[model samples]
Target: MGFKSLAGKFYAGIVQKQIEYQRKNAVSLQQKIFLYIVGEAATTKFGTDHGFSDIQTYEDFKKRVPIRDYEELRPYIDRVISGEENVLWPGTPAYLAKTSGTTSGVKYIPISKQSMPEHITAARNALLNYAYETGNTSALDGKMIFLQGSPELYELNGIPTGRLSGIVAHHVPGYLQSNRMPSYTTNCIDDWEEKVEAIVGETIKEDMRLISGIPPWCQMYFDRLSARAGGKKIKDIFPNFKLFVYGGVNYEPYRARIEESIGFKIDTIETYPASEGFIAYQDSQKDNSLLLMVDAGIFYEFVPAEEIFNENPTRLQLKEVELNRNYALILNTNAGLWGYNIGDTVKFVSKNPYKIVVTGRIKQFISAFGEHVIVEEVEQALMEVARKEGIDIVEFTVAPQITPADGGLPYHEWLIEFGHAPYDLKGFALKVDQALQEKNIYYKDLIKGNILQPLIVKSLKKNSFVDYMRIMGKLGGQNKVPRIANDRKIADQLTRYITN
Candidate 1:
């Protein structure tokens, strides 16, 4: 506690200065950050193409770079991967983060030397903000175990490539690596279950104070630890554990189980770290809204989610953004990604303080037959049912069921695993259908027109999602269930798993 108190005090001071800097000139600081990145890489092919030398202001820069997605930026990234100098950034990209959030296949994203610190600093400040806001520094004193992908690098072209978490783990600054755990031996285990077992064995006796991971995987860790320790709760095993940091999924569904595992509640912090960069984090103690990472070497843009697929969508910079509207996120970063759409949709929760809530992803949906049910609608519907029935759900995914014959009706198929199952499957399915119909007019219209049948709800055995993810080789760390898929690929796989 003494060591943590001192470190917290030091880190808090740095955050307060950041707080002041952000508070004073958020929009202006973002503009300057953009210019600094452009100026540094001005002689590069991309910079030259975008008229980087003539761009003096946000308005000027906006016209030069057209908003794009990963496919659109692949050419430049390919050049960088081939060891071409000054293709995008001033020098070769130090690393590439291969992520699958946008599709079933991987998207190769560059991590330039300039952008690497953005990841580290954003994470560091998230902790600093927690300490400053709550006046609790004990977490800094003990082992801060981060459950992330292994740091082992794989080669693609001439560059090192891995998941973003693995890359971050590899680049952990010299000062914090010694204080972090599990042992290097355990951390390098590529298999998630094996890693969890090793981590539990290594960490069970340590004076651990902080735990960070995606919610479901961390829940699994806590469950394993409790079972190994004669069924005692996490607090009984690691009594000093005071902070739980989580992200990479919506925390609502798994929160209660995690708290129950711990035997009590602890301060929880949320962050929005994508493969591209750290987007936002929980900076206040009072609410769930995340503070935007404005000055972190990333220039931000937002296109109204409704307008995203339009031929010529309006892309709004920071100042033009309005609160409470869903917008697809875009980033032009020091990483040399220009006008790239990272595919996330976020709604501003607070304009005066600049806070946001990640609503869903651009490509995640069940739009079969033009019903167009989005993740937000599905989550809200499930959440409503959970609240009404007093049952906890571990995870769920949706896929459309289309009829092959004219006499048959098309419908939705749901694969759900419950933390605690509800007794009435029929009634529960009715409620969920009603909720979705209420939330989505297209869905209701389809139902009213007899274009779609009532949704089919299938109860999965306990740990079904875990097993499904395990089979997919994505059982831990930052991996998450795809909320919705247009086709039956995910649903079909889950069906096989459930039957067996």
Candidate 2:
């Protein structure tokens, strides 16, 4: 295929346009970038011919606005739902990506007409760059299977609003049609019950060459497939499959179990997709870090990790950012989001400005017992403990709770899943405790000769976490079971079979 007809050229042109814009406005890049975004926002609402007539300068807009979350835009969302015009960007929102809000149960995130192509292109760039870097263009010619959310679309007052996957399925490049499986007509997102049947009955027949989704869902599908095939391996079921792409959450915990069940070692690609945008994705052969979609209709901002939730946090523009420094991401996108904190923390692995490693969520930490444990620290400790014990882990989550101990309440609890049964659970826990103590001063002070002791390891059944998510109505979608819970609420729910 010619480069002009390929998606890569289209994506490269977009990147070049961004670089040109940056170069032309080099004198006051920040102000010019903000002004351009504001102009886009204003023009969309009024008319294409009219631009930011109300706002003239960056300082004028900055003083008038404060950082706002989705809640602050609830009214606009309501108007969109009501089918009222001029509430949002003067056009009907093409699709609404249902996302789990931090405080709200579920939020319908509107994707504007102008920004849909940007989302599509960013996703394409992720794939193209992966193929270019890994020399795996052959995989693109093979069938691609997305073990994603249901293709079911929900109608709000006769308007479609549901999974974004459904929208993507309908709109992918036509040239790629020959390589797609589950033809567009039959690819609708059905409910979980239907999805399970489809997977076992029909969808698996595509001779799927590439698999994609959260690790838990991927595990669930394989389990069902294996069960139906009378304990047949993944390779036996689909001999053509070559790679597994997953993201939205850490894949390390479930890595061994997936390989064990599939009975083969497959190349893996990780992605970072949020309601705001498709942010980053791993190259096909690259395992170290994900490359950022730098030209994907967004200008990036980063706040130092230490100052993420501070009262007065300062942010760095893209040009001023450095590699290997942990920072909380904030974005200003063509989708009309400005200085929006997407609630993800990441660090660049290379000076290329595009490759990064997703450390963890901004608020996902276990500090209830004054341990101040972050995901990186916990993952590092677990890796070290596993190395020392010669055991592999399929999936694991930690929950800390206070139990009555000698004279007062002390933090006492831990849960883990093993790839192979350990020789001594208690001994392994002690080593992990010691490792954590050396790494975290807070844990050290809290456990210094105290009555608090490491609890027993609650060995979970194989694919137990996937089952838990299925029970919670979060299976086969973007929702993922929490990897680290500070309290016992989730753990207790998952462990209902055990008596206290």
Candidate 3:
């Protein structure tokens, strides 16, 4: 395949130069003021359009614009559907990306033309940054496949809209366009059965090198590919494949199974993506943190994680944030979101102002007993225990359930899937218990008195998680099974065999 089909090498080069420049000069006084102005301007527009005309200055904007949840924006969404002139911004919304929330079954987040460019630029920068870091820019010489949601667009009258993926795929450089699979048009919204069949059929015949999308869907595709090829590994299906880019949910649970099916530890890159924008992405070889796209037309704020659940919370400016501190993210972006508490928490591992680790979702924490344990704490505990035990865990989830002991205090029951099962399951459980004790002293104290005994380890059958997701109607798409639950609903559903 001809790699350099377009003379647009300049675009890539320019992005490279900008990345270097921003790395060295991202936190200067000028950059700070520029970001402040951008944030204020975005907020002003957001407020004015939403009937807060008095929000002209920064302080006024801050006071008048309360942090909005998606439910609060339904009125504006209705206006957009009615084809109002200025429902979101100055122009009509070009696209509405559907995303699900805890309360809202499905939401259509309006995407304007102004927002599309930022998504494209951030995505391109992420790809280029990976290439620069790994010295593998030519990886694009082969096909890059995204196992994403149905690419269909929906009309106002409920007609099948074409695939949104195909629409975005077309925007890539023409030189690299041929490397896309299932051509966007054909992949657009079709019948679910037909879409899966087409994706699987074409993927098996193609030279797919780079794969990207939600982890659950990718696992489903890998299973389909494996079965189609008569139990062949994913590496055998795409011999030239080297990278697996996943985001939208935690990859820890699916990690072991995916590597086993692929027959190798494929280079993995995680991202934090949403319908509003692509917020952050892990680099080629970095496990520390994801680098934020500073030039992606989004200004950010950080509210201390401790304050997120408070009645009166204080938020920090980008300049005021520190490394290793968990902060609930607030974004002011070109997508018409201003001071938007997108309900995600992140922690900085670097002070360069552009790199941070996504700790977890704000609402995804397990606090049934008011211990207020976040996902990061659980992940840390798991990683530490695994390291100490000299084992590799593929996936795990913790659920809070009541046992018959001591009048029903909430206790944690862990479901862990290990790459290699230990001969002594009791010892493994003890190590996990000790690790959690060290991280969370309260849990340790409770364990000593038999308030929460070390729970049983229930090893899942091969591909059990995948089958469970399939039953939930969340397989083969954007929906991801949560890694930590406040209650046992999902855990019970996943662990029915063992529980029985």
Candidate that would win on TM-score: 1
Clashing pairs in 1: none
Give the clashing residue pairs of candidate 2, or none: 150-189, 151-188, 151-189, 152-189, 253-394, 292-354
- List the RMSD of every prediction in angstroms: 2.1, 4.5, 3.7
Rank candidates, lDDT, best first.
Answer: 1, 3, 2
Candidate 3 segments exceeding 4 Å error: 5-11, 25-46, 49-60, 157-167, 184-197, 284-287, 386-395, 405-410, 417-421, 449-451
Q: What lDDT tens digits, residue by residue, belong to model 3 across residues 347-452? A: 8888764688888888877666556667877887777666666666655677887763466555677776666666677787777667777777766667776666
Model 1, span 1-500: residue lDDT tens: 47657877787988878876785687897878877988987899998888899988777877888887888788888788888889888887888988775453777789988888889988888888888878888876678899998877888777898888889997777767767999878888989999999999989999889999999899999999998999999999999999999888888878778888999978999999988889899987789889898888888989999888887789898889998899999998888888898888999987766789998888888888887798888988988888779978888899998864456898898888877878888789889999999999999999999999888788888888898888888888778888888998888888864532
Every model's TM-score: 0.95, 0.84, 0.86
- Superior by lDDT: candidate 1 or candidate 3: 1
* Best model number under lDDT: 1
lDDT of 2 by residue, 1-500 (tens): 44433554455556545544543554355445566667666745422323355778544554444445567657666777787654445456777777786566688776777667867776666665655555555455467777666556778755677777766666778876777665444455456545755766765666677788878778778888888889988888888777787878777766777887888877787877776777777754736587676655566778898787776676676566788788888876665555567777888776444568888767767777667676776777777888667688866777776654354655535556566857887788778777777777877777875644543456677656666767777766677766665677777876653322
The C-alpha lDDT values of all candidates are: 0.86, 0.67, 0.68
Steric clash pairs (candidate 3): 151-163, 151-164, 152-162, 152-163, 152-189, 153-161, 153-162, 163-188, 253-395
- What's the TM for model 2? 0.84
The worst-scoring run of ten residues by lDDT in candidate 3 lies at 157-166
